[model samples]
Target: MITVFSLIAGMLLTGMNYLVYRQLIVSFLSKKTGLVCISVITICTVIYISGLRIVELPDFLYKTGAVCLGLSFMLFVITLFYMAGKWLFRQVSLPVNQRKRRFLSLCFKGAIVGAGAGYVSTGIYSGKSLPRISTIPIKIANLQRPLTIAQITDIHLGVFLQKDFLQAIVHLTNEQDPDLVVITGDIIDMPPEAIGDTLDPFGQLKTRYGVFCVPGNHEYYYGVNGILARLAQLGITILGNRTKQIAGINIAGVYDLAALQLQRGPFPNLEAALETRDPALPTVLLAHQPKFIEHVTPDHRIDLMISGHTHAGQIVPFSLLVLLDQPYLHGLYHHDSITRIYVSSGAGFWGPPFRCGAPAEIAVLQLTEEHRSASFLRK
Candidate 1:
């Protein structure tokens, strides 16, 4: 099934390559040149996909390929819109001579090329910039002083982003002086060998109670066990389908659902994680994917859920597509009277180094007693 899915995805991307070539290149360049461009992009797309799934490649080549994939996707969308506009205009306009029509076509394509390049450049700049802080005021269960949580997720360190990014983010998080720090998942993208010393800064992350983490699907692709071990060495608690209590709150985390597809275990057992929960204290569940909220029933009475798998689509158009797979894109949602979930746009970028539309964020949640009674009722 995995192989079949890969093939289907590969064909679609390759097909998109052909469309981009036909729309942008065929008119100005030779057919042979267009074919070569398509071939090269096809190879890069394969490398980018393979690099993400299992294979490891040189960092330079891997990053280059990923960029090519991004460019192809961006141009493909521009081409679609351009073609649609040309068709509509032709339908309404008066007929013109072939020479005039050809000139107008050339000008239109030129404008499209310029616009596409501008969009790509802006996206790259935005993606590289540090994420802004999104402060959220939420209400959790339990009775005690209000608490603050700094959440960092989908930091995909290694190939695209490196220690410099992490270092800066760590600095930003430290400045918040949060009561607790949590990493929902997809923190590392490279193998254990490639990630040495990259996580050292995590040890420097200061918080009142300390840092906590859970596994994301990307972690399983590499060596999750080793990654978890390294986090432990940094004094960060690794909660894979487990619970922890701090400051009158029960914090439980479930392993990402991707574990099931990967056949990786210590599989996510939510039931076991909640077994240690204290009913009197408010409960916050850390999950990688926001869809996990579906598991919450009246019996489980959870106050707040933290998640970060969906990068809020990471880029435009794709953000709309993300809704097909994820229940919530970013920000907080009221799942039920007792359960509220916050899905971060993610602290890092994943594919294109292009975040157009959906900006990245470092979510700082301030849990107060404002909606304590109206938001969650003790069952």
Candidate 2:
């Protein structure tokens, strides 16, 4: 499945590069030169991205490849948008002679190149930075005292992120003095041997109710059992289609949709995960993908659901494409008028290191009866 998806993505990227070369690059240079430049760079980039999955690379090369792929995709998308806007303008404006048309075309091409370069450059710089903490207040009718849960998700721990980054995240989460910490999946993306003690930082988490984790698609790719065991050693509970009652809240967790598709374990049984619960107690479900909100029914009477998988598209125009699969790209949403689902932008990234428009976040959700439920994006 990974190979198939990679091939499809490779084809799409190839087509985009070709189009950019012909439509934009050709305006500045000879066709032969443009073709050579695009072809060489495109080939190298594809290799870099594909290499990330096949073999382990040096940190420098790995980061370089990741940035290369992100910059390529961003430039293509921005150029496409620019061309679209220009076409729309041409449709509305009067026709011009060949000379004027050529000049305008050249100007548009230059703008696309310049703007795309600047955008990608900025993305590379911003992507590696630490995320901000989004403090959200949620009211649960049954909660006795205020509860704070620090949600960490999609931290694809492998080549891109190491123990230092994980420690920093743990430090940040601990500073919040959360009651519970929930990992919404995509935790480990490499093999068990490769991971080693990189996740030891979790041992330092300072949560009262302890930590709970749900499997993301990336977990299945590496070694879910090993990864889960590592988390377990740190005194964290693994909730795979299971529920744990801590304090007065029923926290139920379901596996990601990838579990069913990959046939790694029993498909996500939302019913089983949610069954035999105290209906009176406000229920909080930890699901990896935000789309899991769709499985939630009004009869379930779930008060809140937390998820992080989309990475909020991780990049700009790319986020628009993420919408093709995900119902809500990011942020908090009121589903079914009874359940409030919050889809975090994820604490880490996937393949591409750079986050274009979507910033990484560690969401601190407060469940209390005092304040009305509200969310804010301060950063």
Candidate 3:
């Protein structure tokens, strides 16, 4: 039943995409195609909703459904706003014209609306002080002292982020005065050539144990090696399937899943990287994508694994999709008795400048000891 419902929903979404595409093309083509697209979309939506067992949904899922509906409505409004702006500017070629004036006016209106939508969406999806600090402390037997690590990931420093935002992130991170700072990738959407000036602010970040990073899918899309070199120049240690020691802790980082896939071999051997290190010693894995956890074993003696890739889905309806793809979507999860994983939602947005469901985040993780029980039970 659930599979059937999902199929119907998928079809509806596909039809909606077709309608949106038609709407975009109709602005330059014919109205007949636009009408047909809308008709198909309407029929699909009707069938999809009608076939769903909405009455049987759990309370939490029902609430999620409501949020998804709201998001869809907002997306529809944004699409209309864009279409309206396109139509209003169809004839304007010059910088100074009546149509240009009207287009600017519509942009101002759209901006106001977009801001409100962003605020509302951010509030709804924002979990306070998350990827929450777990009270069940991680015990690293070899560590003589506790380690303070600051993690910032998915800082998609493009379109939406600039100097001011980067400054704020640096300030917030610096406030912690962490022994080590790790960035888990997606630093920018494009190559340094496209955003070198905008990315200058990241060079301001300071950490005592040094800042480290691994490539995200976006970095691969742009140019992984070049991006790594650029970040290296900024004093960030790019850990491409490698390991480094910081304050007696073994920190291992692997390239993104995309990179691993491209290589098409037994690449990023976490076991090989950690082989020289003492199993009793504390180990921190800085994998860019959370999906890496699936291949790991608790017996490997890893203490903490930190990652970011989901962006907590970035928007409503899509968050569910992210969850479906990864066992640990966001926040901390214990795989077995030894290994603990923390998946950050991400520090910035991708594609859309607006961050709907997930707010940008910087995670501060403090390593501590867990209490042991002396009592023994007879089975």
Top-TM-score candidate index = 1
> Roughly what TM-score does model 2 have, to 2 decimal places?
0.89
Clashes of 3: 0
For each candidate in turn, give its C-alpha RMSD to the true structure in angstroms. Answer: 3.3, 3.2, 15.1
Q: Stretches of candidate 2 above 4 Å error? A: 1-3, 29-33, 48-64, 85-114, 371-379
lDDT of 3 by residue, 102-221 (tens): 787667566746764675566455522232222223445566577777888887765445566767777788777777888998878666666666666668777778898887878876
lDDT of 2 by residue, 11-81 (tens): 87788888878666676789999888778667767777667566667777776667667756875777677
How do the predictions measure up, each by TM-score?
0.92, 0.89, 0.65
lDDT of each: 0.84, 0.81, 0.66
Model 1, residue 33: C-alpha shift (Å) = 3.4
lDDT of 1 by residue, 1-379 (tens): 5566667778889889888788766765799998897788888887777666555678788888888888888878787877886787688774478888878777877887788788888889888899899888887655487999999999888777898899999999999999999999899987777778998989989999879999888888787888888889999998887899898898899888887887877688889999998888898999999888887786798888999999988878788888898888887888887788899999888877888878889999999987634332222
Residue pairs whose backbone atoms clash in candidate 3: none
Residue pairs with backbone overlap in model 2: none
Clashing pairs in 1: none
- Which regions of candidate 3 are displaced past 4 Å? 1-14, 17-141, 263-267, 370-379
Using lDDT as the measure, the top candidate is 1
- Using TM-score as the yardstick, the better of models 2 and 3 is 2
